[model samples]
Target: MDLTVTDLACARGGVTVLERVNFRLAAGAALILRGPNGIGKTTLLRTVAGLQPAVAGDVSMAPESVAYAAHADGLKATLTVAENLAFWAAIYGTDEVSRAMERMNLAALADRQAQNLSAGQKRRLGLARLLVTGRPLWVLDEPTVSLDVASVALFGTVVREHLASGGSALMATHIDLGLAEAEVLDLTPCRARSPASAGPGTDDDPFAGVTA
Candidate 1:
């Protein structure tokens, strides 16, 4: 398995956000995690990315094998775009940061402060960070938010290319990404106490009792 999550559980403030979620993904594949608001989509992605302290589960992954792009930029406002790219590249020991920036259409913004860029620009820069990394697994949360239609189309292209390049992706997106042939993994019923008991506005969670 390129990625696997067995008996995973997540919590936030004593609320069960996810429970008993399990899956396996392979290289050169893509999977979409779909749900409505507050259904633990973001939480689940964080868990997969190892950013969130999982409540209970064995999430086996390749070390330094994943790159995550969240809804927030996570950019240093005081730093210029090139500075940001250089900083991340140096941190990751990569020398081809400029090429990644150019691929993300942020080369022109290289001298601009991250704070000064528009939301779309910031998101692009954030994505650039992932591109420059050599990680094999990608965990994206609402990647196309605040982007124009053109940018959204561009994102679909990027994702398709990434899949074609033998990379794997797990994404949580409310909007249709228009990927040519990606599979959808609906976790709604799997995360709930039971399918029959699950209803609208009811999202099943396993760590509902844990704090944070």
Candidate 2:
């Protein structure tokens, strides 16, 4: 699916954080959102994912066609790794847990309870749910939070495969995931500027209205 954002604005706690956010991502591509902490990268991803109403403008995509993975793992501690993925797959009306397990290298840990896994293992399991959702457009917020080097490589491979198969992704990350071709959007300029420096409604983010 082609995802488009038009004159987008976002807020957290009723305070606008970003404005004039615009971008378009076609199938088989990826876009990386970069910025310092608390600059509304997560807020922008949430808006695109439709978790909340956009403060202004439009995000054009069917909410059902988007799969979002937020900062937290969102795993059930008592459930086994496979069980967690299975639960999400069922919710997405899919049953392809086996391949997702293999992709995330969770085959051996399938029966292990989520609570028993280490942090990195838990992160992989959390990301495994993305594959199970089978959605065309993935909106991921810091998808690689606790992953090790090799595991991060694995994530890059998975994302590359997703793009190769005509899927698209929007991700916010502090560290490099080694996605070379993805367009980078620095959100620094998009942050709300101080009233003293700029008038009201100026995009506060430093990267506002810009893409690279």
Candidate 3:
């Protein structure tokens, strides 16, 4: 599936942080979001993933087509690695649990509980969830956090495979994942004017666009 965002606006803490954002991610492609810290990359991703509403504009895609992985690992600490993937597989109605584990290099750790894994292992497990999601679009935020160089390279390979199979990805990361074909969208040009800088007649509505 393809993702098309047009004239998008995103907010953080009830304030508009990005506006006029536009991008088109075709099937079998990837888009990398780049900007300084706290520049609304996460907010934009959340909006695209349907975790939060956009302040304005539209994201065109099929419903339930997106698989989002945020900063949080979103794991069940007591669940074994295999069990965690199984849980998500059930949610997405997919039967790719074992394949997911192998893709993330967690096959050997399948019986290990999430809490017992190292930070990088936990990250791998979290990313492995995307494989079982059976969704065409992946929206990831700092997906390589806590991952070593080898793990990062592994993830890059996984993403490439995803794209090869006609999947699309949108991610925000500082480290290069070596995806030379991926397009980059820098959010700096899309940054919204702060409320303090707004012209007269603009309302200072602190509650506007507040995301839960």
Candidate 4:
């Protein structure tokens, strides 16, 4: 599945954060977004994931073809590693928990409660959900958070395998994970130039304020 974003715009609190964002990710490839904090990297990812609407332009991709993983590991602390994967697999209508665990090197901790796992372990578990999603496109926000060096390497390998299998990914991260080949998009240039003091829709504003 390929992703195409044309003249896209993103906003927070009705204020445009990034504008004219555009990119195309072919299948079996990855696009890494790089920028400073609060630069709308996550916002763009969310818009592409269909979790939120694009403030303008177009995001061309089937919603169901995307699997999104946010910064927070949305895991059930009480559930075991295997159990957590199992739940997501059920929702995704796939029985690939065992393979997902193996792919992320979580087989050894399958029975451990999610809450007991260290930060790195938990992050891996969160990533494992992508495997069971059966979706071709992954939109990840800071997927490397809490991951150790080795775990980051493991994640790169997993991503490579996914691409080899005709999948794609869009990731926002500050560190390089040694991907085989990935296009890097710097969001700094995409930052909206309007000053904060300007009210929405006041002038060339996408979120211009309403008036009588």
Maximum-lDDT candidate: 3
Q: On residues 35-120, what C-alpha lDDT tens digit does candidate 1 reach at each position?
A: 66777888889888887688887789778889899888789999999998888888888886788776777878889999999989
Residue 148, model 2, lDDT? 92
lDDT (CA) for every model shown? 0.79, 0.88, 0.89, 0.86
List the candidates' TM-scores in order: 0.86, 0.92, 0.91, 0.89
lDDT (Cα, 0-100) at 154 in candidate 3? 96
Residue lDDT tens for model 4, 1-212: 77888878899878889887778899988889887889888888888988888889888877699999988888999999999999999999999999999989999999999999999999999999999999999999989899989899999889889999999989988778778588888877677767665466545644331110
Clash number for candidate 3: 0
What's the CA error at residue 159 for candidate 1, in Å? 1.8
On the 0 to 100 scale, the lDDT of residue 129 in model 2 is 91
Sorted by TM-score (best first), the order is 2, 3, 4, 1
For model 1, the run of ten residues with the poorest summed lDDT? 203-212
CA lDDT for candidate 2: 0.88
Range of the 10 consecutive residues with the lowest summed lDDT in candidate 4: 203-212
State model 1's lDDT. 0.79
Q: Model 1, stretches more than 4 Å misplaced? A: 194-212
